[model samples]
Target chain A: MPQPLRYLQIFATFARNSLIRDMTFRANFLIEFISSLSWVFMNLGFYILIFHYTPSLGRDTGWGKYEFFVFTGTALMINSLAGMLFMTNADNFGELIRRGGLDFVLVKPVDTQFLVSLQRVDWSSSGNFLVGLGLAVYSLRCLGVWPSPVTIVLYVFYLLCGVVILYSLMFLLAATAVWLGRNETLFDFWFYIVSFGRYPMEIYEGRFGRPFRWFFTFIIPVLVAINVPSRFLVQSIRPQSLEEWLLPLYTIAATVIVFAVCRAVFQLALHSYRSASS
Target chain B: MAAIEIRGLSKTYRVTRKKEGLVATLRALFRPEYEYVHAVRSIDLTIESGEFVAFLGPNGAGKTTTLKLLSGIITPTSGEARVLGHIPWRRENAYRRRFALVMGQKNQLWWDLPAAESFHLHQQIYGIPPDQFTRVRDELTEMLGVRQLLHRPVRELSLGERMKMELVAALLHSPQVLFLDEPTIGLDVVAQYTIQQFLREYQARTGTTVILTSHYMKDVVVLCRRVVVIFDGQIIYDGSLTNLVDHLGDYKIITIRFSDGQVPTDLSRFGKIILREPPRVRLRVARNEATEVIRAVLARYIAEDVSVEDPPLEELIAALFASARNSRLSQERGNSAVPEDTTHSANH
Candidate 1:
């Protein structure tokens, strides 16, 4: 039908084929799925132990047990989206370049970036995503905060924004593999950067924290990713100032800018690509 | 119009050089040495549409590099090329849809998925209509005799069966031009013959321009009429295969079997003696002198059997490269005569 619809259809086919491939190694898939979910549960347990002694993350920062759990859930959701969609492909991008697998990708009639970024679907990562959703609903219920449908819709919108930001950052890191030849440290670096978003932004409010907060909030924008969406759910609990209400707009703008810049970087890397000799 | 054209096309890569040993490896991590490798030098050529041409070369002889440049897999270091009226490196979708590059050592199909699944993916990627996809896929699989293997995972198939499936995947789009880089490599004689027969029939039916790079001489002799030989990143010869044999192969091989009890004392006047057995002798005679040499041998000896034939293409090609190397060495030495020792080294 239409071009965009055709691409979506192709993406669906890729997802279907990936699932079939995964089914071929069903035992390994189950192991990975269980391991991923275990990590989510372990994190939840660690935070529950912390909430045992502290009333809030910061004395006056309004981050109580349920509020912080909401933030944790939002971070997990964003990370899982990225992990499912781009992690496997990005991790394999270096090998593809090194072993000349990208030559086949470059010759395809579809968009190179689109195909490379979305070719593999990690269905196992969705386990963490479902767990994250459950935590978010559980925390919302614990807070006795029944969000309106509009608030829930806004939460989903901002959750997508968070995923887009994470994807752009991960993609940009993966694109560097073209020049670096091999970047095995990319996942380590990605986890380090994303760990900052796992907690409430209020944790970074002191002397050294001020600049860290400002840098992540404005430059990398990871702080805003989970903060805005988690805050959208508890808007009544912590009423928003004008600037707080404008966070969604800022998230949109950041997503557009980061997406465009990363896309350009990826294209420039592809232009400089000297394929491995056969 | 020519389906493919190239002038001064080249590719140079900056290769990192590292020394052996742990200390040097550690030092290289801080500061690595670099050298420029000219994979393909200035080369000029053109091929008409629907022409099947063989690109023959030894290892590291720039055959694959030229194909990558023409297929838009990699950009050139300098110069220009146009395929089907479009610069290949520009990589417009329309251009890509009309051409296919199949590398024997690399695969596009997913390892865990069935070949049929990959075919469907190609149909989507190329935006092929369902009917056209099915017809082309069935025709190719049927021709290659691989219809039964399409539903099995690609990893489980043998190399020859996998290669046939790869060909089917590449050709399902009905590309107007096909670039095959060593398609029949590492295959048994029967498998190679099967691929060759299918290629010949496919070329005849569709008139697609095919440029194949193969180490197998039989693939070239059976499928392509024209051949381009490359050495040291340059085009050394380009003409019909028959012309290649005529131009470089100037001698014929003559084998003579004498009656059991008879032996010729001297046959030097007839030709250069290549082999000598008690009752049989082989000689390399100049093409023009072959008839006269045979006449003289028959007159001088009682022959039970006699056979005269052109040397195999493999020998002709080895001789061509050895001679080319010899000339290059002589030119480097600033002499008109090749050293006798160097000739032995070249032959080996």
Candidate 2:
């Protein structure tokens, strides 16, 4: 069989096995699914309350209640997809290091990165993804300006790019477990970093926020992950500046660079892995 | 070509040196003293294909570390090794595909899922054909008597059952080289014997090069013909298992069962009386004198049964480790004047 086909087959098997594993603990799975959905719903409620008093999220930013909702929906989908695919696996990386479960992974014929990154899928996160999709469609209908076919395709492509960026970031943090022994603090860092991506990049444009905007945009590239994809779906927003026009290309470039860097770091970390003594 | 070849392969780890007590803990929290641990040091070894070699050593003797290095689970700090003409530390897919490593303590299978699910995942990962995968999986499960347990959640299975499933997972790829690290670490005698029998049969049929590190002497004795004893991160002895006895075991144990409580008096005249029950007595005699001692005992007492056996491999190995430690201690004492290097090196 061809290599790519074999990897796809492996990933399919992994997804199926993860579903089986999740189904084995039926009540826990349901509770997790409900818990994730409740979080998304509560966040949406908070936004709804805020929108009641304001015409737009920011002054002269053209992000109306529904527009910002679209952005929020994009963020939700991207985060949910990332959570579904890599969250559990990345969270378990430290445990794998501590318990030496990685030794078997390293010995497999499959790519170590592929095996470690996609071994387990958090199916519960799919609930949040469906909710995010509902919010996006509802917001689009409320706005009464549906995106073109080309725009939708571009939006989906950029949404996938966003997911990849998030995966790469989480993976890079997880890879540190090899050196740090226990990197439970990485989730704290992740929450802090991903929080910035939840809001519009325009909100971080003042004196204090400019530096953060610049840092997250160019250095970490988290801001552009959701911002550019949201721009594609929110038809009212048009790219007027050269930087804005290049944002989509920049997100694509960042996704590729960040993913490549993460893969390289993961491999380097594997070289350093001392696999807890048997 | 040899299945495995290593030249001066060494692995040194920089581990934190923690002192006890509040002051020391605080000092360590700030200053953090570290020391180097030579896990595997300056060792060279070669094993041909289809050879079942047992790596015997006490804890921290680098047996598992050596296996990890050979299987590409970890890189060596210095030197080089090639398993099947590929540098193991390079971790090429081709090299990885042809080799398998089974650790008894770790579960590669998903805990909540059945062993069959994990087996299917392995088939996809290794790209084993459907027919070949089924054949191999069925054959392994049958031989290990785990066919019924395949559908049970791995967490629900007993340790022995889980270990059998782990073996099946490791062997699904039909690897040409197998590395087993303490594969019978926590198992009952029956389970251990079953695995030992399976491994013996599998290695015979597959012609796979097998390197196993096991503390269980029974595993080593039953499954391996060649034994390599490691001590202090060094290869202390490497030869056939039988020769290991002939070379280090100087004594033989003789057991005589006297007829109807007619036990001999003054048994010390014959040899060192190890066991002195009423009708049955066991004596430890020099290997050269074992036959004469047994003959004399038999002639003197109406022996219903007589048996002569070499000293247990466990005792011989323990003695080997003690002697090696003593020599190492003396060598360290002789070199006490040398300055110790406290500088921490980069962990590999």
Candidate 3:
């Protein structure tokens, strides 16, 4: 079989395994679904609180677009990325590598990087995904921005870019297990970064913060998940000169670059994994 | 052509020599001197396809390091190895897909889920087609008698059950090459035999190339046709089990049953006595003098019954290691015949 076909086969197999994994614990899925739904409602209340204190983001106020502001951007971004993959899935790979559980992947005839990254998925997070998309649609109706077919396509493309960026960044961090030996703290550090993704990048300002934001821009570009989709909703928004071609193109380009770098690092790391003796 | 070829395979590990403590760890973190432990010295090996080979060694003998190099788990520091005509460390997906490595101490199964769930996940990871997947699963689980154990969570299974389940998981994809490290560790005798039987049958059916490392002699003796003995990061012996026993077991065991209340004569000059009780005298006699020794003992003691037999493989292995270590000690001490402690393992 062609190599590309094999990659797709591996991907499909991982995805199918994820489905079986979720079905394996039918009861846990229900409990987790309820827990995720409750978290979504709690976040929506937090979203409403953000606009309540700032009239600039309140309905009918001068900059009145809280519905568009909150859902199409911050709240929607959180929910969408939450379901793309679990934070634990990234952490588990590192632990697996340290524990020698990853030898199974090394001996198999599949891309270790692909198998490691996509092998496991937390199905419970699909609850967060569904709720987030529902809220995004409801808020879009409230803003009277139903999205043209073109905007919808762009939304998916950017969303995919955002997901890829996050996955690649986390994978690269997990790949550090080969060198660092224990990537537990690093895995937690990435999830901590994900928490920061819940807000717009404009909130923080520091000379050092620019590099921090650069991570979301040049490195992972979670900014694309929010800023681009928000542009489709805000009527007054305009693509500043180069931002038009540059942002999406950079998002796509960055995804490819991060994935390529990850693949290279992963191969280098595999060379270093002397199997555990104890 | 060699299906697997390793030339001058060497591995060195950077290990901290200090004991673990807060003070020691902190100081070591900043300016620690890492001792380069040569886990595997320059070693050469060529294994043909479909060979059931045992890679045996005492603790830290570099047998596992060699397997790691062969399976692409680790790169040799200053050597080259090829498995199925590919550089292992490159880890081409094609290469990985064709082989499976099972570490006895570590598990590949999901902890909280049934073993079947992990198997399904494995199927997807290997991209085993549905029909082949079903056939392999049914046939392997059937042969291994793990059909009843499949639905239970791996954490809930006994160690033996878990080991059996691990084999099913490893072989479910039908890997042409298998690297098994102490696969029968922590298993009951029956479970070990069950696994050995499955491995023999699997090898016979698929012609899979196997490289197994174990402290257990039965696993190597029963499953492997060829044995490679490694000591101190070198392949000292590479041949067959019968040859191993024959070459090292050149002495026969003499157990003489004599009449009660009779002390046996000082027969130390004749041979090395291994055992002496009230009415039993065991001697280690050369193969050529066994008949004469037995006649001499029987005539002298009016023995009830005398038996002569070959030593156990374990005993021969122990003697081989003891003599090897003794020779090395003599060399190190400049032929002083150093009176070193031999009450314990000479290799130790």
Candidate 2 residue B281 Cα shift, in angstroms, is 2.0
lDDT of each: 0.88, 0.89, 0.74
How would you encode candidate 2's per-residue C-alpha lDDT over A5-73 as one tens digit per residue?
A: 888888888888888888888999999999889988899999999989999977878799999999988
Residue B33 displacement (Å), model 1: 3.3
> Which sections of candidate 2 miss by over 4 Å?
A235-237, B260-265, B340-348
Clashing pairs in 1: none
Alpha-carbon RMSD of each model:
4.1, 2.4, 4.9
How many residue pairs collide in each prediction?
0, 0, 5
Off by over 4 Å in 3: A1-36, A57-86, A202-220, A235-245, B19-24, B127-131, B148-152, B258-281, B302-304, B323-348
lDDT agreement of model 1 with the native: 0.88
Candidates in order, TM-scores: namely 0.94, 0.96, 0.86
CA error at residue B23 for candidate 1, angstroms: 5.3
**lDDT by residue for model 2 (B1-348), tens:** 899999999998888897889999999988988788988889999999899999999999999999999988899989989999999878889998899998887878888889998999888877888999999999999999999999998999999999999999999999999999888888999999999999999999999999999988999988999999999799999999999899999999999888888776788987999998978899999999988987787677788899999898899999999999999877766665554632212221
Relative to the true structure, candidate 2 reaches a TM of 0.96
As a whole number from 0 to 100, the lDDT of residue B296 in candidate 2 is 80
Interface DockQ of each model:
0.79, 0.85, 0.54
